[model samples]
Target: MKLISWNVNGLRAVLKKDFMTIFNELDADWFCLQETKMQAGQVELDLPGYHQYFNYAERKGYSGTAIFTKHEPLNVTYGMGVPEHDTEGRIITLEYPNFYLMTVYTPNSGGELKRLDYRQQWDKDFLAYTNQLAAKKPLVYCGDLNVAHQEIDLKNDKTNHHNAGFTDEERADFTKQLDSGFIDTFRNLYPDTVTYSWWSYRFHARANNAGWRIDYFVSSRDFKPYIQDAKILTDIMGSDHCPVELVTKDLI
Candidate 1:
């Protein structure tokens, strides 16, 4: 099975930028998206063979997530069941007979760390949610987690030490998540490699290749054998973020 996760930044915007062509070329068994930034009825997609699921934020044109898959899931759920956190439409979980697949758009710690406290709480709650699913069966979750997990995860680690995504608190929370029972697939596969999934649109960041590996494919540690490979598709162009991939052995 093949899966792709990307933060399109805005689905409506990308649709006009050859998104269909790029989507067709990747041809993943499962394609998950974050930061769709739109509500229902705003746009319709023409993905011929996929079952689509979308979770739209309560506010229009804000945080949202989606999943398009070739295989239909046994069950589908939106949000984490916490009203406060669910309001943003940040999560979508698709349950199959053997595993659960989730896509999340974690909240960002805003300017001056104003939202840091809430983001920390989110990390804790999100981990608990994933832990529950993993206890039942294997779990594969992906999307823009909004954290550059380590010094190696961003190009200017020292310079960005206090920045939203690179802050120590955010990094430690990610470490806690991985320590709990999950594996960061790409880093687990290529620990020494330096690649990034997200870049700032300002300052010619992409042109200079100054980026952060904020997006990811994470799975239950025991499910590691199913993951054949993980990749950061840096060459792909459309959003400030590129798509990340996970190739797996057939689970069904």
Candidate 2:
């Protein structure tokens, strides 16, 4: 199975910038997106041979996520079942016979760490939700988790240490979650490799390759053996972020 995850930043904006063109090229079994920033009917998508599922934030033009899959899932869920956290429409889960596939746009802590407390709560809740699901089935979750997770996951780590996504609290939350038996697909595939998915629009970050690997394809530990490859599609251009991909040999 081939899965591709991208933080499109803005679906409508990327649509004008050849989003469909790249989408067609991927031809993945499952394609996921984060930071979609739109509600239903805001944009029209014609993805042939794919089932489209979208979760929109209550506050329009903000956080959202989507998934386009070739196969229909047994069940689909929109949130983590936490009322306080469900308003942003940041999560979407599709339950297949063998595993649960989820895409999440984790809350950003904001420029001055204003939302850090709430973000921390979210991190805790999200991990619990995933663990609950894992108790029933293997999981394949992907999206812009919004944290660098480690110093090696970003460029200029020293300078970005205090930044929103690189804050100590956020990083610790990620570490704790991973310790609970999930694998960062890319890192597990290439332990020391350095690559990034999200880049700042400032300081010519993309041009200089000053970026952060905030997006991820993470799975339950038991599911890792099936993953054949993990990739960061840095060359594709449209949004400030690029697509990350995972290829798994058939295990079903």
Candidate 3:
């Protein structure tokens, strides 16, 4: 099975770019998206042979996520059942017979760390939610988690030490999540790889290759065997973020 996750920044915007061409080329069994930034009825897609699911934020043109999959899930759920956190429409979980697949767009710690406290709470709650699913079956969750994780995950680690995605608090929270029996698929596969999934649109960041590996495919430790390979498709262009992939053996 091929699973692809991308932070499109904005689905409508990218659709105007090379999204359809790139999406067709990847041809994943499961394609998950983050930061869709639109509500229902705003746009319609023409993806053949895929079941689509979306969680739209209460606020229009804000944070949102979507999943398009070849296989129909046994069940589909939106949000984590946390009222405060559910407003942003950041998470969607699709339950199959053998495993659960989730897509999340974790909240960003806003300018000057204004939203840091909220983001920390989100991390804790999000981890708890994943734990609940993993207890029932193995889980594969992906999206822009909004953290650089470690020095190697970002290009300007020293200068970005206190930035939103690179802050110590955010990184520690991600570490806590990983410690709870989950594997960061790409890093687990290529420990020394320095490729990044997200680059700022400022200062010619992409051209300079100054980026952060913020997007990811994470799975339960016991599910590791199914993950044949993980990749950061840096060459793909459209959004400020590139798509990340996980190639897996059949689960069903």
For residues 106-202, could you state the per-residue lDDT of candidate 1 as single tens digits? 9999999999999999998998999999999999999999999988889999988898998888999999999999999999999999999998999
Candidate 2 TM-score, C-alpha based:
0.98
Residue 68 miss distance in model 3 (angstroms): 0.3
lDDT of each: 0.95, 0.92, 0.95
Please provide, for model 2 over 94-177, each residue's C-alpha lDDT reduced to its tens digit, 9 standing for 90 to 100.
Answer: 998888999999999997999999999999999999999998989989999999988889998998888899999999999988
- Candidate 1 weakest lDDT stretch, 10 residues: 150-159
* All candidates in order of lDDT, best leading: 3, 1, 2
Tens digits of per-residue lDDT for model 3, 1-252:
899999999999999998999999999999999999999999899999999999999999999999999999999999999999998889999999999999999999999999999999999999999999999999999999999988999999999999999998999999999999999999999998898999999999999999999999999998898989999999999999999999999976
Residue 247: error of model 1 in Å?
A: 0.4
Q: Report the Cα lDDT for candidate 2.
A: 0.92
- Candidate 2 lDDT at 222 equals 83
Worst lDDT run of 10 residues, candidate 3, spans: 191-200
Clashes of 1: 0
